[model samples]
Structure formats: C-alpha cells, structure tokens
Target chain A: MNTNFTHHQSAHCENGVASNLLKFNGIDISEPMVFGIGSGLFFFYLPLLKVNQAPAISYRPMPGFIFNKAAKRLGITVKRIKFSSPEKAQIALENNLKNNIPTGLQVGVYNLTYFPDEYRFHFNAHNLVVYGKTDNTFLISDPVMENVTTLTEAELEKVRFAKGTLSPKGQMYYPTHLPSEINWESAIKKGIKNTCSDMLAPVPIVGVAAMRYLAKSIRKWPKSKGVKVANHYLAQMIRMQEEIGTGGGGFRFIYAAFLQEAAIILKNDKLKELSFEMTQIGDLWRDFALNASRVCKNRSNVEDVYNTLADQLLHLANLEEKFFKELKKAI
Target chain B: MKKEEIPQDESNLSKSNVKELCYATDENGNYTTGLSTGWEAKTIALESSINTINERIEEAKENIKSGKASPIVYFMELHRMDWPTLADYVGLWQWRVKRHVKPSVFKKLNNKILQKYADAFQISVDELINYKGA
Candidate 1:
C-alpha cells in the first residue's frame, strides 16, 4: 500500500488533514484556507462538560468539522466513514491505501508511539492521514509532525479504537471529488458571514459570549470551590489557550492570515484591516493567558487577578462583537 | 502567521519544547520559536504540568499505601481522570465508583467490574489490582 502522499507539518491537526487531502486530490488548498472557509473559529465553555476534571474550554470546533465544512463550502465531494470494529477499519483503510487513496483518521493521541511524550494526552480527536504501508508499518502524515512517520499495524489499531471521550471508532475520510475550480468571492463571503454568526451567536455559552461565560465560571471557582480549584481551572484555561496545540490564539492568527489572503483575492481593503485587528485580538488573548498563568502560578492573588481576568475577557468579547459586525457589513 | 514566521527548528519533542509550535513571536517583535533547542515558556508549562501530575500520583500512592483507597484510585489519577470520568468509562454510577475507590469495597469487586476497570485502564485485571505506576 503506497499512496506516496506528501507530508506537511501544520499548526492544527484537522485543518492540516483537510489541506493535505485537498492537496493530494489536486485542489492545493492551504491549511489556513481550509480552516477559514470551514469557519473553524469557535468557542464553547461547557462547565458541565469536564475534561481532566476541569470545565471544558475548547478553542475550535470538534475534529473533522473543518474538513467536512470546508469541503461543503468549496463544492468538493468527500466521503466519511466510521467502522464499528478495528478489524473492519483496518481492512478498509488498507484497501484504500492499496488503491493509492490517502485516508484521514481521527485517533487517540495517547497510544500513538510517534507522539512526543509530553504532548501525549488522552485526547482522542486528533487527526492524521494514513497514506501507505510497508511490511508491518503504516506510513502516517500526522500534520503536527515535521515529516512522515510510521506506525506498526498493531500500534495503529490500538489508537484507532482508543477508549474514552470522543473515541474515533475507526473514523476515516478522504475527498472523493475536488472540483476543478472555485468561486472564491462567494466562498469568502459565506465564510466570513458564518464566522461572524459564530462569534455573535446568541447563546450564553457560545461565541465570544463563551469567554464571558468562562470568566463568570472562573470567578465562581474561588468563591464556591476554593482557591486550589480556581487555580486548576485557571491553569486549564491557559492550557486550552497556549498548550493544547496552538489553541485559541493560534487559531485566531490562522484566521487572520486567511483574512489577509482573502483581502488580496477579493481586493477588499476592509478584510486586510480586519486581519490586523484580529492579530491584535490574538495578542490580547496571549496577554490574557499570560496574566491568567500568573494567577495559576500562584504569583498573583486570586481576588486581585480574577477580576482583571474577567474584565479582560469582557473586553475581548466586546472587541470581537464589534469586529464580526463590521466583518459582515464589510463583505 | 506569515510563512517567514514559521519555525526553522524541527527538533525532537522534549519537556523543554513540549508545546512546540511553528510560530512564537519574541520581545523584539520577531517571529521565532525554540523548536530546535528550547523555550523558557514551554519549559515552564511542561515542568509545571508534569509536577502537578507527579504530585497527584504521589498523593494517590500515599492514599493506597495508607489503605484509604484502592489501586484503582491510583490508576484513575495516573490516567489523569476524575471519579466521574472513570465512572463513565466503566459504565458505573459515580457513587459506585466512589465506593470502589475504597480498598474494602475494591477487594469485593467482581470480575466483571474489575474487567471493566482493566479495560478502562487498558491493563490486565492483575495489573490493575497490583501494579503501582512508576
């Protein structure tokens, strides 16, 4: 099984897989483009949904979301399948690779031998592409890696069906048909519109509103659960921001880069300006993480820091609110 | 986010470059990363997280050694889980999981329950019952 797929390291997993699949299919879409057209920017603070015993704070949408959504927006046809058992999944993937079709998979990072030990968590939504096999090893294009790597068929099997939340269950996807051309203008408009909608979504726990929601939850932690829990909660927030694979701020930067590209393609100066503004917001987010880390580090007092952190989030939400509004009107 | 900002360093992952990424701007406003060698921020975060994990594992070890909790509790903490997460994995109620955390109840856990836990921890029942994590 040899698909001879080219591997390119990417900032984020799913977006990288989407871009690589598109490139393999001759579409040549960049990762940022896929992330943008997919409307990959999102925020959801689910205090009830615990990850590592802390409230869930996700910077982006679920795995495979960007690929599925971007393919739709670009008029590309893609096939997605999930297997009930590891045997069937392996067989299907082997057949695809034999046919020279690279397959994208969602697998748990915990069991992937090639993953850096420090980076390996119980995360099960990580995405990578499997394109070839030799002897007992499967060649994998993990977008986060610098080069192609190999996973033994046995090793691959475990990660494919790894247990815990968001189990992949052998989920795999590939582009069945990528159109020869694209309507960039309409695509850009739709992408921007959807992103604007996401940032402005009315739900209290979604969009920029979620930041405020998370801040409120942070404030409650010190009062309700005590300082230690609050510290963990804050650390988790920073992890969600800086540690977990170029998270919230990183995605924002990627989107800003996309907007910069869109500005050029659509000849819209406003998008270029928006891109700059978004970068500044990304910087603001980095600052938020820095200060929040201070509180987590126990270098700063909780009462002294929580209010500042909460206010920072409210400020970010307000900036985002206005930015998205202007973005919709600009397009 | 620019192409120029992408890190030239593709060093292997270590605790120092644990959160390695392609872009990390510096104080000089230059886009660079310690991907090849190491960066102070990445080092700190990695060490802190590892320390936290270690401290928790030590606590769990003490809890087990004192006979206040079972090995299951230790493994759960080792797996970076809370009781609710372990409960979800084993399809047991939180109360039942809490009960099972105690050595008195754990000694009486049936093969089925032990198997559920072993499956969750991805270990043999014997290993689940006996092994202390390094």
Candidate 2:
C-alpha cells in the first residue's frame, strides 16, 4: 500500500507471496503492515471489482462441517493437514506411494525463503512438486504426477532435494533446497508456505451415493417406471463425479438433489425419462470435474464452469418452470 | 509582463535596470528587502510554476482520452514535478493517495483494468465470428 516508503518493485501480492520482510525489533514484521495497507486500498476500490474479492480471515466451522457430513453420507474418507513443512510434505507423498493408495496427490510449496531481503512466493504448480530420489542424488518422477512434467537433467541439479516429513502420516520425499530434511530445521528456516491441499477418494464415492439414493427413491413406486429412467441418468452422474473430483463435486450434489426431489413430484412416465437424461448430465459433470480438477483451480476454469452451467440451465429453464407448475397443481 | 496587469511591485523584482533588481544593497550591507525576497516576486514565480504543471497535466489527460497515453507514462510525468511546481501543490495528491490507499485496492484496480481489456476482447471475438457468417 504505502509505496512511498522508498522502493520500486512489483510483488506477488496474493496467496502467500512474500515481499521484502523488514524487521525492526527481534520480532519478525512486514506481513501485518502489508495486509493492513492492502485492506485499506480494497475499501477505496470496492466499486472497481463490482463484486468484493475479500475473503473472511477467520475460518468458518459450518461449511467445513457441512462438507464433512456430506463426505460421511457419501462414505468417502476426508483428511486435512493444517500446516505441513517441506520435509513433512515429502513424507506424505512417499507414504501415498508406499501404501499404493491409488489416489493422485500433488504437494505445493508456496513462499520460498531465498535471501531475507528478496523472498517471493512462487505458486507455479510445476516447480512445487515432489520428485523421488534414485540413489544419493538421482531424480525420479512421482507416480501420481508421472503423466505431467518429466524432470530434465538440468532441473534436477538446480533444485536442491532434501528429505522431509509429514507427522502422523510420516510420508517422505525429496524436499528440494532445504538445508536439513528434518521437520524442525525445514520449519524454522524456510518459513511455512500457506498452501491448501485436498485429496480425492481413490474411487468416485459421490457417484455411488447418488446412484444409491436414486434407486431407493424410485423402488417405492416400482409401477412408476419413469423413476427407473431418472436413476440411469443419475448413475452416469455419479460415475463422472467419481472420476473427476472436486471440479464436479459441487454441481454433482446440486444436480443429484434436484433429481431426488424431482422423482418425488413428477408422474411415473415423465419422472422415468427425466431420470435417464439427468443421469447422463451428471456423468458429464463428473467427467468434467475429474478430468480437470487441478486445471479448474485456475481462473479460466471458473469462467468455463460458470458458462457451461449457465448454458445448461438455460436449456432446461422452460422445463424447470413447467416442473414447478405441475408439482403445485398435483399438491 | 502583460502591459495592463503588471503590479507596481514589479519594478522592485523586475526593474528595467538589472543593477537595482540583482545587486541592490541596504545600509547594513544586507541585500535590500524589495529586490530578491519580496512577497510579490515569490507569488509570481509560484504562479508561473503552477501554470506549467497544469499545462502538462492537461496534455496528459488529452493523450489518455485519445487512448494514446499509458498510465505509467502519466504517472511518471506526475512524479517528475516538484511539490511547489503545481498551482495547488498536486504532489500532495500522490502523498495522500499513498498514505490512504491499500495494496489490495491497487491490485483490485489492476484486475478491473485487466477485465475491461478481457471484455473488449470478448466483444471483438463475437463480432468476428458473427460477421464471418454474413
């Protein structure tokens, strides 16, 4: 905010990007002042974004609880590591490999403590990977990320590799560039990079949940064959959700809920046909998410998802209106 | 220097003879009051400097209106002026802004600017595709 202090510089201003950290007393300072100034600027420019981009500083318990409940209802295991150092992060990757977890995991190292004066956070997913070591100093590609970037010979030499840990999980990996691979050493020196890590279930459990719910909702009205059609459509959605991950996770829930609600209201024949087509849409949503979870984390993914959902909603806008009307009449 | 507008104090600061204006001395050997340090002369110089800065700002604004000026170029031009150079002490604008505005505000502004460019691109793309059919 106060560029007047005395410097010319472009900084990575967000997502744990560290600018020059100045220390006055023995205590470390800089981040607090920067955030304060940035927040002040945000107030001045609120009209510019039209929508406010400020995120709440404190963590909300409700959303996490809701997600946890959803996960449990769908029978998927959810795990979180609040703050893992480089060494500990490496260990998590190693454990995933050793256990044959069959799930893809990528670790990101955010702010790099270069020199005390010129530290910057690098959020490039490519650079923040965990590479396996062959012997004393050889590099190997992580199995989950094998399809992505293959390490070149020169890259291996420039990036320092040290062993790191993830306590409890206790997985191991080459913690590139840290002086000591031990947890305390890595934690103290490098400073922790605030990165959010999420893991997808080995298989699409959400898909299973959707299908099970669909089957249960329709079996009551076996003579109402339209329910069967809806189940088929929902089954496809579940499959896609399982394959894709977080990208499709939100929409999968919304659509699955819509279908479940629809079965209750619609007549037998109409419900059956609606279910069949919806199941396909569900599958598509899941595929889009699973195939593109990491990719969707980018800004373009936001635009793509919004546009796709908007277009689909437009297509069904009339039908949706009719569904409401008929349900009201029946009641 | 305008014939009708010249003040009577002009003779002290801008006399016809350079000797009185540049080297006038008092009885005590200190320079006389009316020559170099007169309030009238100070006010004139301040006015002229302000006019020059205002003219420059006007030109920059025109350039920006025409879509020919870069924000960085205008910002740097504003930077070059001294505090007293402008009529209203416009350097204070930057100081006030620097003190009040937050870094996130600047970032959001930059993003909004970028989004405008993105919207412009989207419009052009739509036009291009639609026109091709015609």
Model 2 C-alpha lDDT per residue in residues A32-67, reported as the tens digit of each score:
122211221110111122111111111011112322
Highest-TM-score candidate? 1
Off by over 4 Å in 2: A1-70, A102-272, A276-318, A321-331, B1-134
lDDT of each: 0.77, 0.27
lDDT of 1 by residue, A232-265 (tens): 7777677776554563364787787788778889
Model 1 iRMSD vs. native: 4.3
lDDT of 1 at A302: 43
Fraction of native contacts under 8 Å reproduced by each candidate: 0.10, 0.00
- TM-score computed on alpha carbons, candidate 2: 0.24
- TM, every model: 0.89, 0.24
Candidate 1 structure quality by residue, lDDT tens digits, B2-54:
33443332333543343344543455433333332332333344555666777
What is the CAPRI rating of model 2's predicted complex? Answer: incorrect
In model 1, what lDDT does residue A321 have?
A: 91
Tell me the fnat of candidate 1.
0.10
